[model samples]
Target chain A: MITLYDFELSGNCYKPRLLMSILGLTYETVPVDFYPGREHKSEAFLKLNPFGELPVLVDDGLVLRDSQAILIYLASKYDKTGQWYPLSDPAVLAEIAIWHDFANRITATASAARLGLSMFYDVDIEAAQAGAHQLFRLLDEHLWFGEREGRDWLCAPSHPTTADIACFPYVALSEEAGVPRQDYPAIRRWLDRVKRIPGFTVMSGVFPAGPAIEA
Target chain B: MNRPNPYLNDHWHVVAGNEAVASGQPFRTVLFDVPIIIQRLADGLRVTAALAPEKPLPVLERYGFIWTSLGTPMPLFEIPEYDEADRRNMNAGSLGVAVSAPRAIENFLDMGHFPYVHTDILGAEPHTEVKEYDVEVSAERGEVLATRCRFFQPRAATSSAGGQEVEYVYRVPHPYCSVLYKSCPSDENRRDVIAIFCQPVGEERIVAHMLQSLIDDVSTITDMRRFQQTIFGQDKPILENQYPKKLPLDPRAETPIRADKSAIAYRRWLSQMGVNYGVIPLVPRVADV
Candidate 1:
């Protein structure tokens, strides 16, 4: 059995849950009050995670902290389709690693700004929003050219991988953080593609798009 | 930011969807940066400003929405088709858009961004031409009307299966409200009505309320909602990134082309009304000049 210490609103917590849902892996969540309650910072909770961050996962006694690490582990061990974490492809592996890092930058800036604006937190909102736009420009250009060359995802694979899931939540929730994706048409298209994934689910503020218009 | 602008204050803006103000529950929202709360009393909904809870403000419930104003407003505008038979009228829901009300109305009037912003749904590539359209502000009715607008769309509605040329007629009855009469998928003789009633939460914040009245029998309400939401979701990002975040009433503030006829007319109408709440007025600031 897999147990995830989760906050309902935390995008980091959602990352693992999304992959788990897509993989059809059954898991239970120990709900943590991350907002006004701040249960994650409780002394009892500190034993589970020293950093006081959310999304602490324990799968059959194996503890995992970071959302990216949890994703790699879940996808590696349970993804029967083998497309999410394709260990056989060394190039794909490198590409996924780069995007995982990019996803962290998004969390630091986009999620931080969201915390400051929507959630109560002492975040440097202006700097965080500026940082998010800088990263969005790069991500948009990469996806824009990818479409030109008939590539559809963050990675080169025709099929979506964990890289797509890793970077989706914060970018999708950028609006709540006041960092608009309007200037990035390619990025907007990519978000729709992500929503159309077979097992995609939605959190608050994130709604599903209708089925893609048949080409 | 919660200062007075009589032109807008005198017009109705949607505060909440009628369903949102449930009995025994209090619904809170902001209009023109002033927080207002609505509670279902024994008689009806009692609306009051957050700061002045003692004094009750007036509210008109109609068209699946709750309409309100800070001052005396003209009678609500007419939607003749709303009373017609055989239409599936719906409150498609509201989205909090982070842009001025005028910016949202401009985007709603624009057919030019159909190909780029709402690609493959409202429009597709290579069919980007926004054909010649007629735009005018009615002298007697005091409304902005744009007719004969046409565009090729890949999938115009949830019921649409393939591409088709969609005809459109745009109407702006209120400064923050826009209505679109588009080609209905189920009926050729009739048209689908899509309206956005923007609540000016602040100068740069809007709560866009959508009302869709369609002539479709095949598509489920959920499917229709997702279709409309998908289109607006696509537009939200593009709308939010507009440079000033406020629509400039100055004709020379931003460059325009023939394709921007309806939007140009909207700016002109707003300027004539002297709505200064969520727009950069036509006159330049002396310090900047």
Candidate 2:
């Protein structure tokens, strides 16, 4: 069975869990505790992924670190025709890539910065809030346009690709990280659409109970 | 003692009292940091601040005065644009305007439609009278309790035409939330009031924030919640698809029957409040279906 090292509360960790469920793949969750700072920074875990993230996926001895990359890998390995990954069209892939970048560069970073300020460090909260707001506004604008234009999924038309899986968890959990979920109604609608998909499993924070355990 | 004008510092307003001004009189008393007049006539309630020189005499005479005038006459136009803080607070969200309607409280009491439009989704049966109403009120909020009669109806069962008595408890969270309580006569009411928060986003557009809780006692709450979700899902697409301009009503375009009483009443009420009422464009005869 595919092994997913995850923290339930972490949106990044939820990415793989959601994808695994959607893909109907059975995977064993190896729970990691971030409170005591135990497994993340361990030397053996670092050898698997130097970044010390909890969502490191180990399948057939192949290690995947970044959440987006792990999602792409999972889709390619399990799904046929890359419905989630969509390898047929370069333009489609490019669109998906933009959202993937947004998840990593903008949403992930801003969410982490804001979460760090609130949860871990005593950094300038105003600055962190500002960063979070800025990111939310950007996502809101995109979602607003997407909803108005009658687009079915983010990053593509009608069908949800890896791009949606890549970004949905963070955008959904951004509220817990102090990223004002209510401010973005269109994004909320988009999250609902994502939830209605067949074989859908909500990210840990989206619902109180799910397969994943809270980090 | 002279009370400081709360409206001067904040943008929020509250209802102070509901009193009968004259025998056979029907007026809603609203305290907006200042006394205001709300007279309910055959058409609807006409709200005016107590500052206008044109007394209620003309309005009373013109409408063939019958009811009692409750508080002193107030000017409808003299009520200044709310203070900046209230303006900011009110405009903080896109759906704020819907919540700002004076009749929102009354509208929440309506539970007749639970089984019709949202029947399969909410599991409400028609023609059923509410058996019990439990109300809980506090300084911050209030709740109303409603219970439905028990039956072993499952999703697979065909819908019976007969009605079931349902119970409802409405809760208000002071300025923001109005949570519905969960109680079940059979098990327990586990349903939550579907609260709608309106935030003003633009001159004409308001975002509508809605939340409903899952309750255990009422199996119907689950179905009703699903139905509400479906209705909202449909409404969002249509509302979002419409032009951002406030829609006007076209009386000749579509004939409204008794089933549309609530929506029609709400529209008339809004019009009386000086809210711009939009009319849905007339569909072609061929598009009637």
DockQ values, each candidate? 0.08, 0.06
List where candidate 1 sits over 4 angstroms from the true fold.
A1-83, A86-164, A172-176, A179-215, B2-4, B284-289
lDDT of 2 by residue, A96-124 (tens): 89889888755545556545532333355
Tell me, what's the RMSD of every candidate?
Answer: 10.0, 17.4
Chain A of candidate 2 gets a TM-score of: 0.87
Tens digits of per-residue lDDT for model 1, A89-206: 9999999999999999999999999877643367899999999999999999999999999999999999998899999999998988888787999999999999998888765457
C-alpha lDDT score of every prediction, in listed order: 0.86, 0.48
Q: How high is the DockQ of candidate 1?
A: 0.08
Q: How many residue pairs of model 2 clash at the backbone? A: 47
For residue A205, model 1's alpha carbon misses the true position, in angstroms, by 12
- The 10-residue segment with the lowest total lDDT in model 2 chain A: A203-212
